[model samples]
Target: MPVDEAGAKAKGGRKRLIAIAVVAVGMLAGAGGVYWYTQRGSADHAGEKQAEAAAAEGEAEGGEGHGAADADPTASYIEVAPMMVNLRGGGAQAKFVKVRFIVVAAEGKTDAVKGRIPVILDALQPFLRELRPEDLNGSAAVFRIKEEMIRRSTAALGKGMVRDILIQDLIQQ
Candidate 1:
């Protein structure tokens, strides 16, 4: 009877040890899987960086072959004066948005676009002033703002004068 009781105790201990070992192995596997997932993302980003570097090198080589006349005339940009406007809705504290941008003009329309800077500003000021803080919350807000800027610029400068507007800085305070 004593021998049988000892044997049963040993068997129970062995089962508990096996269960602990299995749980430890499972934890190690989970950690390894997490490490692998994070490393895969970083590797993909590194590949993108390499591809961008290669493209930049290609552009540098290609640019050296071109002369002044070969350059695109509409590639010139006109800088706009920065504007600070108070936002429409802020109950207690006043909110203001400041922005600086450059205008890209259509082919042979650089002078026209430059001359209409004040008119463009006139059209843009009211539209910008009306924007609430919530209006500028997301990535889509930027796209909407750009589209509206282009529309206002075209209205001010007439059709085909303004090509695009590149926002240099946008700050909210």
Candidate 2:
């Protein structure tokens, strides 16, 4: 039997609404995928940048180590002579700086203090090894040792304390 015109119109209307719904669903899915793609790209870029920074820092540190290693361990010679510093008479101190010394080529004022190494080392080694923990606790302790070496050379040695006081190593021992 043939359908009436009203029935045919109703069927066409239903098909139209179904098409609109399907298109809307497809648009939503495509937009969501694009958003996810952009976010993934951003995350990947951030990770790459982090890796580059770490590599740069590592290279810098390696360069510094090589520069130090290439430096001459002895361009001059200053000996510690001997140390007789008393540690227990005052208090049981926790901070002590035991340093091995050598003489190095004078930089600016090394010549001015090269003669009194025997006298200066006599005063320096004992003094350095007797400092309390409070004395050797800061980052500036190395500078302090350098200054002390210079001062003692000027005070005990004529105007020269060998070439230069080279602190070979500083340890608590």
Best by lDDT: 1
> How high is the CA lDDT of each candidate model?
0.73, 0.53
Model 2 spans with C-alpha error above 4 angstroms: 1-75, 81-96, 105-116, 160-163
Candidate 2 weakest ten by summed lDDT: 61-70
Clashing residue pairs for model 1: none
Give stretches of model 1 more than 4 Å off.
1-73
| Candidate 1 lDDT by residue in tens digits, 22-75 | 999999999999899878956764554454444333332333342222255546
Q: What TM-score would each prediction reach against the true structure?
A: 0.58, 0.41
lDDT of 2 at 2: 55
* Model 2 TM-score, all chains together: 0.41
